[model samples]
Target: MEFDYVIVGGGSAGCVMAARLAENPRLKICLVEAGGSGRQLAIRMPLGVAGTVPAFPFFRFANWAYETEPQAGLNGRRGYQPRGRCLGGSSAINAMLYTRGHPSDYDGWAARGCTGWGWEDVLPWFRFSERNERGTDAYHGFSGVLQVGDQKQPRSMSKAFIAAAREAGYPLNDDFNGRVQEGVGLYQVTQFFDGKKRGERCSVAAAYLHPRLDWPNLHVITHAHATRILFENSRATGLEFRRNGTNRIVKARAEVILCAGVFGSPQLLKLSGIGPADELSRHGIPVLSNVPQVGENLQDHVDFVMNFRTSSTESVGYGFRGGWRLATEAVKWWRTGEGLCATPAAEAGGFLKSHPELDVPDLQLHFTVGIVDDHSRKFHPGYGYSAHVCVLRPHSRGSVMLGSADAADAPRIDPRFLSDERDALTLIRGAEILQTIMRASTMAPYDKGEIHGQDRMRGAELMDAIRSRADTIYHPVGTCRMGSDAVSVVDPMLRLRGAENVRIVDASVMPSLIGGNTNAPTVMIAEKIAGEMKYNL
Candidate 1:
């Protein structure tokens, strides 16, 4: 098969690229996904996330479910890394929180040799990709493909969380994506609020791909596992993939874009002989570009949760009462599109400084009206709630390496979470801050004491708790970093450094981790790249 563009991984970025590039009738685009059909009913339903994303059966099936190599930083524990396998990618199975990250995050990238990635330059791309229910302003767009809206109706515990944060001296800011982000309020979700898809999870496939499926120029191929990029003399010309137990090759007339995300992108690059010289030589693969930075600089937000028992049955948890309530709430979601099912476990959060002297908020807090143990693997009986605290920008970095030469094997992932002493200290302090909010007057009514750690576990013991329990908050980036530096994998234009007709537009290209959720920023990257490609073509 041949096409003008062969986009690998029909995730967040590929969906947008296919939709945008297909606007030109003469251009042909093919989007390939290694997972199942993206039209799962559970994936579209907001409440189904509890089952699809957290539960073991569906979680492993819907996600790549890649675990990191044992890390010395976390007392030799392997971190869980789950990437979305379906068409929308992680956006389909995620919490659906729509965060554009701090404006300064992009500015910091630009300051660090990533030209045209400053806040002002990327803000328009964000605005252009959003169709916020709150209406358009200088910061948002109304006619965009992606749906951004407020939560249908926050649970009572979620409202209490906001009040508790305010009682703890934090301000109440309704819009985190607006002028300022340092406050506590309900999170806006990437959920549709209009037309036939009202109240559904607005995944990238639903927002971009599904809506444009009728376009003759676009072809979406599912269950196509891309094994390697077919290169000819340092130029990416096509891709070799496996589908239904058969090997297939497809040529790219123009470009081969890897939207396979942080892990998959770097893994594919290295598998195709494009990584460090030493690693490729060890694997016995002929070197192509010898790009040392292909899989380096892995970064993720390491989160530590503080759980507390709650007297109210309003919080999400196990028990006959909670189950019955959830059943009734599910009906309400089906009939009226407003209830617990309509919102995520993380209804509200806050961004604050670990130390008052810090220039920007160093800590990001996620408040859940439920107990989340081991990524919801274990359920606690009765009523309980959790508040997760994580460092906004961790100092530690890790890498992704080839586990084997075989394309079907998972890569060796080492996030090395909290390896840096500074990251551990900041998270330790951040957990203390979360404890303060839980003890505030407003929260005293529901607070039933600690469920995870003890107050006596101070200093060394507390640091031990962080090390023992700290895990990924699910935002991973910086693997295939984009910059103007010599060692950078991708240039500021998002094109591969030494490879021709190849570009990577995904979370992997982020020069650094953003201050908030990565879904919105990832879409912005695709939108900006699509705009550029339109003019270039």
Candidate 2:
């Protein structure tokens, strides 16, 4: 098959590119996805998101489930990093919070030489691609396929969390995507009207791909895993892909956009002989572009949880009763689109500075009404309130490298988390801040007692407990960063440093992880990239 554009990985960015590029009507585009179509009920229900991981058949099958190399700093524990394998990619499996991050985030991106990616330059596109339920404004749009809306139902505990934050001296923000992000509030979500019902979280697949299924000029091939890019004289022309034991080649006449995300994009590049020459030679892959920085500079947020038992019998608890509560919540959502089911597990959160001298917020807090024994769903059955304090702008760095030349092989990912003493110190400080907030007057009314066994511990013991329980908040980026420097993988326009007619349009290109959730920013990157591609074409 041949097309004007061959977009690999029909994910968040690829979906946007397909929808936006196909607007011309004359262009023939092919979007190949390694996963099947996203049609699971769990993906559509806000609360049902928890089931997404267990329902693996409905997800993208091509996901290279990579584990981080054992980290000496993390007690030799290997982290499980899950990237999406389906049409919408991680956007389909993620908590649907829509946040554009702080303005300084983009300013930093621009300052790093990502020319057109500054906040002011990218805000318009963020607005252009969104149809915010809050209505139109200088920062939001009213007419776009992607739906951004206030949560359909606010959890009862949300108010308490907000009050506690305010009582702790942080301001209450109505909109984090607005002028400032340093406040506690209910977050907006990526949702749309699904059959007259509002607050129906919309995935990239539904918003950008499914709506265009009837376009004759566009071909969407699912279950097709792109193995390697076919390049000649530094120009990408086609790719080799496999489906059901059969290998096939598809040609791209114009360009190839790799939206395979942070891990897959770099792995594909290395498979196509575009990474570190030394590594490629060892793997016996011919070097097409010896870009040593293809998979370096990885960063992510790490979180520590502090749980408190609430005296209110109405508190959502764990076990069989919790199941019943969740069932009732689901019924409420089905009938009224309002209830606990409509709320993300984490109800309210805030961004704060670890130190007063810092110019921007460095610590983040996510307040959850229900207790999480383990991040995994299997162990998440307790009834309590919890706060997750995360260190934003971590100084730690990691890398991604090839395990072998074969596309089927998983890449080695090492997030060297907390390697920097500063990162560990920041997290420890964040835990102390959370502890102070829990003891505040505003939160006293809701506090029944401490839940964690080490609740009575203070000072050194508390810090040690925090360190033992800290886990990832699931935000990872910068493995294939974009910049003007030689060490960078992609350039300011998202093009690979030494590759032509190919671009990476996903979280992998993020030069730095933003202060909050990455879903909204990933979508914004796609929106901005589409405009740039359109304008240049």
Candidate 3:
């Protein structure tokens, strides 16, 4: 089989590319996904997000479930890194938060030699992809493929958190993606509010791929794990893959674009003999290009959670009583699409600066209405809630390397959490701010005091607690960072530095970590690059 463009990984970016490229009926496109169709009811129901937690069956089925190499900075604990394997990729399992980071983030990228990535350059692409329910504005679009809307019914505790944040002296900015980001408020999600699928998550698969599957030029192949890119003298010609316990090869007539995301994209490049020479030689793979930085400069947002028990059962928790209530909510959601099942656990959050003088917010806070311990692995008996804090622009960097030569083996992921002393200190300050917000007048009624790290733990003890409990908030990028520098793997245009007819269009191409969730930024990257591809063609 052959096509004009072969996209590896039917993820957020891949779906966007497929939908856009398919616009020209003459160009054939095939999107290969490693997982299934991602049509489970748990994936569609907004409140079913809890079912996608670390050890659940739904998570195992639809997620890569990659665990990090023991982080020395975290006192030797392995961090969990779950990437969605199904159609919409991580968007299928993410919190559905629709954040575009800060405008300065893109400006910083442009300043770093990544041309055409400044705030003014990328904002149009962001708006072009968004069909916001809040109506069109300079910052938002109204008639686009992807949907952005406010939560239909947020938890009462979530509203209280917003009030509590305002009481803590932070401004109540209703839109973080608008003029300001330094404030506390409810987050808009990537869910659509069309007259039909109201409150349904507008995953890239639903927004872009599902609606256009009938396009004669678009071919979607699920359960097709890309093993390696078949290159002819540094020019990617096709991809060899494994499907249904059988090996197969599909050629790309014009180009091969990789949208496999941070972990998969770098691993695929290394497997195809396009990474560091020494690493390739060690694995007995013939080297086609010696791009030493293929898997280096890994970055992520590491966070620590402060749990609090509440006497009110309004918080989501498990018990005989909670189970009955969950059943009732499930029925309500099925019937009218309004209940606990209609909202993500993180109903509200904010971006703030740990230091007062910083131009952009350096810390991100997520207020969860439900008690969460180890990504919901450890269940607490009664009602409770949590305040999570993370240093947004961490100074620490890590790498993703080949575990072995085998393509099926998971890549060795080491985020090196808290490697920088400044990151640790910033998180400590963020935690202090979170504590103050939780104790504010708005939360005083439901605040039953700290349940995890008690208020008594001071400087040294507090730092120790943070080091032991800190884990990734699941935003990883920069392995194959885009830049004009010689050491960068991809150029500013996202073309592989040493390979032809091959482009990397995923989070891995991000030169640095953004200050917010990575999903929206990932989509914007695809929207921007897909336009570039069409222009070049």
Candidate 4:
């Protein structure tokens, strides 16, 4: 079969691409996804992050439960990498925080040879795609595809965390996505709210694709695994995929846009012979282009989660009382879309600098209303709260390589977290700040004791404790970075070097890691690319 455009991986970017391009009515677009339809109850409910994010075997229907190679820095433990496998991708499974990172983040991309990616140039696309519930402003849009709003019934513990941070001297910020991205405050979430109560998750599929599913020019195919790109010499002509154990080809009459995310995108590239020469040769595949940086320069935020037992029932936990509370909350949400079920447990967080003298915030913090041990894989008995401190830009870098020639096998991922001394030092300082906030006067009424403390330790012991606990916050980026340099994987227009009719529009194309959540930026990239495509057409 053939279409004007064959977009692979119906994640965040793919949803935006299909929706925008299909608006032309004359242009035919086919979106191929390896997962199921994204119309499940868990995907729409905001609190379903608990089941989808940690991704236990039984509940991982919408999650690609990929694990990393054992890290030498984290006491030789393999880390979990739970990517969203359905249409909306990780946005459906992630904490619903709507952040654009720092404006400097996009400027840094332009400075790195990506011409039109600077903050001033790309902000319009961000504005064009956002439909914030807080009303239109210079920074936020009102009538756009994606919806951003405030939480309906955030737990009291979340406010206490902010109050404690303010009491410890950090200024309170009203909007993290406003003029400045530095300070402590509650985060605005990506939810579809109505008049009064909170709302459901506004995933990319829900915001962009679901609304336009019946559009004549758009076609969505699920359970279709892309095995390789159909290439005629240097041009990406179509895609070879598998469905029900049968191979099929979907020809791209216009172009093949890839939105398979950081790991999936690079893995497909390597599998289709568009990666490092040595890597392709080792995997028994002939190299089509010698792009050595296809899977290089991998970066992620390594977060150290600090847990504390709390006496207050406001914070989340797993017990008889907590279970009963959830039962009532479910009813409340169904009736009015208000209660704990409406909350994305990671309800509050902020951007802050490690040193007072630093220019931009080098650290990001997430305050969870529940104990988040081992990405919530390890469950505790009683109620507690968690504070996560992550290095915004890590000095450590790693690579994604072919584990086998087959596309079915997962790629070998290694982020080499905390390999640099600077990251560990920053986390140690950030941890101290988190501890101070939890122990402050505002939290005294609820604070019981520390579940995992670094209070008594200093220096080496503290370093060891950090090494033992540090893991990725699931913000891996930069594997297929876009730039104008020779070593870069894609060019300024997100086109692959030495290749024709192919482009990337996802976190894989980020030249540098941004300072906050990546979902918003990924959606913006798709908006920018879709605009370019329409303009040129």
Candidate 5:
């Protein structure tokens, strides 16, 4: 098969690239995904996140809930890394928080020599992609594919979280995406509130790809597992993939863009002989380019969650009152398109400085109405609320390595979480801040008692709890750093350093992880790259 552009891994970035590229009728685009179309009920329902986030082998859809290599920093525990494997990617499985990290994040990229990536430079791309429910503002767009709106009915606990934050002396800012990012408030979600899809999840595929499926210039191929990039010398010519039992090759006449995400992208490159040479030789794979940094610089938010069981049914859970409420809410969701199932359980969050003197916040907070133990993999009998505090810009870094040369094998992922002492220290201090907020009068009524990390509120014990239970909050990036140097896998233009005609438009290309949930930034990256491909490049 031959196409002008072959887009691999029909995730968020791939969907955006295909849709935008297809606008030009002359360019035929083929988008291939290893997963199914992201039209499952679980992916469309806001609360179906419970069903999708757990992902494959157990739940069988949406998520690729892979685990990390045992980490010495986390007391030898393997961390869970759940990525969306469907068309919408993690946007279908995430909390729907629509956050753009402090503008300084993008400006930092520009300062580091990535020329067109300053906050002022990329703001338009963000606006071009978002349709905020509150309408267009300096920071948001009202006419775009992605819908950004408020939750239909957030739980009382979520509101109380904001009150509790204020009671703890933090200022209240309605928009985290606005001028100042530091403060506490309810997050603006990427959910729909109008038309037939009202109260549903607005994943990137739902926003960008589904509507364009019938376009004559676009071809979406699902359930096609990418094996490797087919290269002509150092330039990526196309890719080889398997569907059912047959391996097929799709030739790219113009370019091949990899949107297979952090793990998938790097793994595909290495399998195709474009990674660390010494490591490739060990796996018996021929060295094509000997790029030492193909899978290096893995960064993620080192998250620590604290759960609290509440005495009231205002929170989400499964006791008698809670069960009745849930059943009634299901009916309400079906009847009027409002209630528990209509909202992502994590309805509120904030960004805060670990130290008051810092210019920008280094810690991000998520307030969920349900008790999230082990990513909701483990459950309890009662209703409760939970709060999460993650070191947004972690000092620690890790890597994604090959388990073997075979394309079917899972990559040897090692997030090396909490390996940096600075990360641990910031997280430890953030935990203290969370405890202080929980102690506020506004949070007292809902507090039955602590569940996880109970009584471990002090110095060494708090550190121990973090190490023993800390895991990723699912934002992973930098496995293919885009920089202005030789070691960087991609250039500022997002073009692969050693390979021509190959561009990467996923979170993996971030030189550093942003200070909030990664979905929005990842989408922005795709939009900016596609815009350049059409208007600038």
Candidate 6:
């Protein structure tokens, strides 16, 4: 098969690229996804979203399922890393919090030599792709396919959490995606109001793929796992992929874009013989390029939850445990998308600095209506209000290396979390802040006692408690960092530093993870890359 573009991984970025490139109608584009189409109701219904996790139809089967090596800094714990496998990638399974990150985040990218990616240049794409339900403005757009809107009705717990943050001296931000990202408030979600469904349901697949599937120039192939990139004279030419027990070679006359996300993209690059020379040679794979920084600079945010029992059972946390109340709520969601089903797992969040001297927010707080013990609902069942504190600007760095020459083998991932002393200190400070917020006037009305058992401890004891409970919030980036430096994997234009006819358009290209959720920013990156590709083409 041959086409104008052979885009690998029909994730967030690939979808945008394929959809945008095919707009000319004369160009042929092949979009390959290892997973199947995200057409399940669970993926469409806002409340049914949680049920899609265990459903092997996508997550378990098509996902690469990469886990980090036990980090010495994290008490020798290996973190569970889940990347999306379907048409929309992580955007398909992520909590639909739409955040563009702090303006400084993008400015820093430009300062680091990623030209045309500064806030000024990138903001246009952000507005271009977004069709805000609130309507268009200088910072927002209403004509795009991607839908952005606030929750239909803010959960009671979310309201209380915001009030508590305000009482604790934090500002009440009506819009986190607005002029600033600091403060506590209800998050804007990537959803559309569905009258028949009683709630909002939308995703990148719905925004970018579903609307354009009928386009004759666009060819979407699901269950097609790209095995290797076929190169000629150090330039990407085409690729070999496998689907349903058959091997096929496809050519990209223009470019072969890799949007397989942070984990999958880098893994595919190394498998295609484009990575560190030593690592590739050890696996007996002849190196196509000697790029030592192909998979360095891995970073992520780690969150620790502080749970509290509430005396006011009227709070939203009461419906968490399974029973008649939970069943009733589920039925309500089934009938009308206006109950617990419409609520995101982490509803309310705040951004703050761990220290007074910091210019930007280093800590993020996610308020939940239910108690989570190990990220599994089956493990813990109870009525509890919890706050998850995550260190935003972690100083830790890790890498991705080839496990072997085989494309089937997963890459060796090592996200050296807490490797820096500053990260540990930030978490300790964030935990203290969460404790303080709970004591504020807003939470006084609902105060019961320490539910996660941190109230009983103080000083060193609290620090220990935080260390024991801290886990990743699942935001990983910078593995294939973009910069002009020789050590950088890709340039400001997302082209590999030493390669031609290739580019990486995913979270892995982020020089650093943003302050809050990364889903929105990942999509923003795709939109930005699409514009750049169009202009260059």
Give per-residue CA lDDT, model 2, range 1-537, as digits (tens).
Answer: 899999999888889988888877778999989987865556666665554543344433423345779876667777667666777887777667787778898999999888888889988988888888888998899888888877755666667778877888878888888877777788777866445545455888888888898899889999988899998899999888999999999999998999888888999999998988999999999998888888888888888887777755345566777778778877877787777766666667888888889888898888776665445343434567778889888899998888888888788988888889899889888887787777788778778776676545677777667656666777888878999887788888888788899989989899999988887788889888888788888
The deviation in Å at residue 384 for candidate 3 is 1.4
Give TM per candidate: 0.97, 0.94, 0.98, 0.98, 0.98, 0.93
What ranges in model 5 sit over 4 Å off? 56-58, 319-324, 453-456
Residue 53, model 6: lDDT of 42
lDDT of 3 by residue, 309-392 (tens): 888776787899889998898888777767887788898999998878999999898988787788877878888888899989
Candidate 4 stretches greater than 4 Å from native: 195-198
Lowest-scoring 10 consecutive residues by lDDT in candidate 5? 51-60
Best of the two (1, 6) by TM-score: 1
The models' CA-based lDDT, in order, is 0.87, 0.79, 0.88, 0.88, 0.88, 0.78
For candidate 6, the per-residue lDDT at 336 reads 70
Please report the TM-score between candidate 5 and the true structure.
0.98
Stretches of candidate 6 off by over 4 Å are: 52-64, 194-200, 309-331, 444-451
Give residue 348's lDDT in candidate 4 (0 to 100).
87
Evaluate model 6: give its TM-score: 0.93
What's the lDDT for candidate 2?
0.79
Model 6 collision count: 1
Please report how far candidate 5 places residue 286 from its true position, in Å. Answer: 1.0
Q: Residues 344-381, candidate 6, lDDT per residue (tens digit)?
A: 66678878888778888888888866665544333344
Q: Which structure is stronger by lDDT: 1 or 3?
A: 3
> Cα deviation of 467 in candidate 4 (Å)?
0.9
Q: What is the lDDT of residue 13 in candidate 5?
A: 91
User: Candidate 2 or 6, higher lDDT?
Assistant: 2
Q: lDDT for model 4, please.
A: 0.88
